[model samples]
Target: MGKIASAHAYANNEVAYLAWDIDGKIEGCLGFEVVRIYLEPDGSVSLRDDGEEDRVPCAAWVGFKGQRNPHWLPQTTSIWPVQKLSWRDLTLRKRRNRAQLRPSEISVRYEIRPLGDWRPGLEPAPDPVPETVAVAKRGADGRPVLDADDRSVKIEAKAYDGKPRPLGYLGPAVATNAIRVTRWIGPFQSTFTNGVLAAQWLRNVIWEDGVKRPNELMGMISDPKNGIRKYLAGDVLPMLRELFEQAGSFLLALYELDDNELVDLLLANKNRIRLILANTGLVEGEWDVRNSHARQALIDANVDIQHRMFNNSTHIGHNKFVVHLDDDDAPVAVFTGSTNWTTTGLAGQTNNAIIIEDRNVAKAFADCWHRMLNDPLDLPTEFDDGMPDNQQGAPFRTSNETPARFTLDNGAKLEVWFSPNMPARRKSSAIPPDLREIYRLMRKAEQAILFLAFYPGQSGKDCIVGEAIEIGRTDQRLIVSGAVSSAQAMPNYVPGRKNDRNDPEDDEEAVSPHTFTEANVSIVRASRLDDRDLLSDFGGEELTAKGGIGAIIHDKVVVIDPLSDDCAVIFGSHNLGFKASYSNDENLVIVRGDKALAAAYAVHVLDVYDHYRFRAIEAELRRQGKKGWSGFLATEDTWLDPYADGAKGALMRYFARG
Candidate 1:
């Protein structure tokens, strides 16, 4: 007989996306129950040290807004089925003490079981199966073991505590393929920060005895602990420290270098580090004023350093990258991304960093570093113009040189490009090739185009935001969603891109800076419900919006057709704008045909988008003196009815199936 259901799991570092589908319709189907099994070192799905099966906990408690008898209670996935077709297990652990599992030390797989026979009023469904299953053989510690060898053993039969059974009833459990989830894929290690300091978790950390402790939060940023930093600065800092322990010389380029911890790191390893620091471009003052501490420290430590002021020029040195060379001075690996070497860049802003261990990628970056070292004042004008040995040129400036494509072991195509493609003295009217390629990808997107930007240039000819808007206006069926921290990144407020225009084909109609709910194109600004909004529904908890920390949506990422084979993700320190392309020293990498990586980025965009969409709407409602978020959950199951039709259902199905 055919299996009743099948499940799939995609994991990256700390989070796993779980999706399941039914083979056929079930009578009185309620939802699906999910259970995660932590395998032993030998791949045995054994009971945990606490004698409890490794079942994932529900992050949210499902309950009615006001009910005399509430069904919501703290429970595992085995007890309360997930109401959605897919769920994300953010807290993947192995033990009862709640210690996070290291990806290398553990292996995990999931089992999905369909739950049916729902009673009216959505009362808890009866126990679908036994609370715990009996193991045929077990050790004194309660973990399953082989009868002879005393080694941890695998259970072939499906049970609540052991391996899944092949045969079962109508709601048979379907197991997903196991995965050793890690942030490191092949020679690449990608890391992102929690960066949302305004989140409730931070509030919990800072609040003690009815007082908010900002100092405690600051301490956490400086010295991350308990995974609270969420690999933001934590992962990058450790990687740098690892390099210092190795026998390698380093090549460093940074825009801002004021973080105390990072400066200490550089100082400790100054003997082997060749540094190129830049001005923040905030003020035209003494070249070394902003980064004086780090620069002065490195200088005192006798490190080989060059400070690039980029003075008198409109462009600022905006690169934040590091390259490592072996003892023989051969390029080994390179770390490059949007993150700057500053406290705010690390712990405050939403940023990303990637460490690529490929020698070819490292060599390419190293060649650019050498070119910059040769000409600290002005970037070289040509790479192969037969210039004298003293006049080396920039490798990434010419179209023939850059948009360099590299193929990874997994068949993902990577294209790297550095900026300042145009001449230094002249302002070109033609669109830069780097940005035109991005616009082309957006226009040709078959399914969806999603992006998150700090400020991808104001709405104009060279603006990536404007290009996305124009594409949305032309093709109403294409899904365009994005989040931006700056208000200028979006257009003026309009009800709808298509409906507001007197003629549907009009090219000059103002696009909405706010959400375009009807046009299949939605853009939201980074905002939250502040003191002005009523929160009585949430136990009178206040959500205060603290400003000036840093950019909340600092990521410069664009995902085109994420679920398709032709998926492309354009991301890096490049602002994805004209100025970044024609002036600033920046890096951009385009990754294509890596569905897993594309989906990771797609989920990140959607996560940030959904978080702020409500806040953006609430802020607008507050502006209009209207009520927002009545602080109530749906009293009836009819709330799910909205997902049966319309754009909502379409979106739900699109992501669920993927």
Candidate 2:
């Protein structure tokens, strides 16, 4: 329709990514208007007695340069269309006041209609189909049709706005694939929090409501029925609640047990929960006090608790996982990722959680929990005195034997490893086994190497970031992109000489000039530009910092060659560094040959990286006294030239071909 070639969509729990392809060159086409049609789970039209099957018009917050307004009133794409071929619909949510339509339970499709020349004050055409009729079975003559199959039945039509001929009349709409807006991927499900404080939606909400502090903001959007809580915790809390309802016992190992809601849930289900609670080290007193209070409650209720009260900072149990066992004591599923069980961990930082429904994976994690419960200190029988950190032995020791390898029911291959398994006295040049496996993948990455991390161990040659940097330097054809929570997490890149990946100097801000210059590597730090330094259109609204957690990017993930058949996703509590492998209690999994899972993770990595890359660059440009380049859109179409050549062109081609 309308020379449109293809339309496709991908969705997670919170957002839908819609893209389209045109048949030929856009000779003089202005833009496109996207309309979303929320459908039933069976892919049937949404029929309602009170209202029409909501044909929601996707829109942009800002208008043209001269047409912009101070109120930030959004203009529907039907009038002011999107200039790009693809858009992310962050506004998708469950229909309000409908308890039956849960998050990730409904499906949606899109229609991409090309827009022509337009003028001011143009309104969309009147509705053609009546509210009483659910389907467009009749033709323009308004006569009922006899033969109406799924392929022949009409569901939508082009929009009109009362202009001449092609002008103000939308082109024929091309239908896109229908997909359930969910986080499930076969036996694996994942969710990510919208916890970036400087995000556009959060900023708009804060500016409009004058809501300050995390609790206030949380209270404003905490209604589970409306699915707004997904903004703070994604599906983590819901998934946990559902797991609690299951007829199973929970094996939970936590570093921080302070979220009141979670504590309440645990107490309610205390009869089936066995917890291994750890200390938060010599840290904040508030966290300690709250944790102690929560722990005492669980203990008072007689919950089976194994307290790993190691007070040292360097060697503490840093695991957050829950393994579910059936009533017969057989493993069913496991929940493990970078997320902690604190409100700040769920609502303050960007984090991820994965639910692996494979029994073997759950069993592996269950084994780790059992080992920790049995031997909290992981002491060696010989009691060696020449430990690396002047300790009796490693705090976690699942690394002595080979990691568990499994073939999932869906043909996905997985290798799981637990930490604190390093030998008491190993060669100085030896690499940690987990880090070694990650390096092997990094060295052999063909298409792209992407990652997101928050201080994944000290930046050095032994870390995954350093390995990616070295590979990107040597192979200019590869696409290597990464984002860390801070600049200090990156290595000090050098031009010709070796990078100082393992510098012992205690410099928080490491200089890496060759990041986007001499090498193909591009490392962006999670940051925001000062409001005063931004364009005048942005005004002087300050960014919000909520909760106690300082880190904004807490996800620890890596996707290698996500578009290829050899895709691998490395994630979990593992920090992708030596410390996590050799000294801390962590779990890392490597999934090979699962392109779907890899692509999902790749989308998330690129999403977070792209969001922060512009902010980092904008801040850097303003600091260098570069004006006009840091803010505002170009007045004319000259901005399109960059997408036809150079770095932008290469990136566009990479994804288009992939």
Best of the candidates, lDDT? 2
Off by over 4 Å in 1: 1-9, 18-46, 50-52, 61-63, 67-86, 93-179, 213-216, 223-234, 283-290, 311-313, 378-401, 424-429, 493-518, 532-546
lDDT by residue for model 2 over 147-217, one digit each (tens)?
Answer: 43423343442222122222244457887877676678888988777666655545444543222354565
User: Lowest summed lDDT over 10 consecutive residues: which window, candidate 2?
Assistant: 158-167
Best by TM-score: 2
Question: Model 1 clash tally?
Answer: 2
Worst 10 residues of 1 by lDDT: 383-392
Badly placed stretches (over 4 Å) of model 2 are 1-7, 19-32, 39-54, 78-86, 94-102, 111-176, 209-230, 284-290, 378-401, 424-429, 458-461, 492-520, 539-549, 628-632, 649-652
Query: What is candidate 2's TM-score against the reference?
Result: 0.79
RMSD of 1: 11.7
Candidate 1 residue-wise lDDT, 363-455, digit = tens:
877877776776655422421111112211354355323566789778888887777776542336677777878888888997788888887
Q: Provide C-alpha RMSD values for all models, in order.
A: 11.7, 11.0
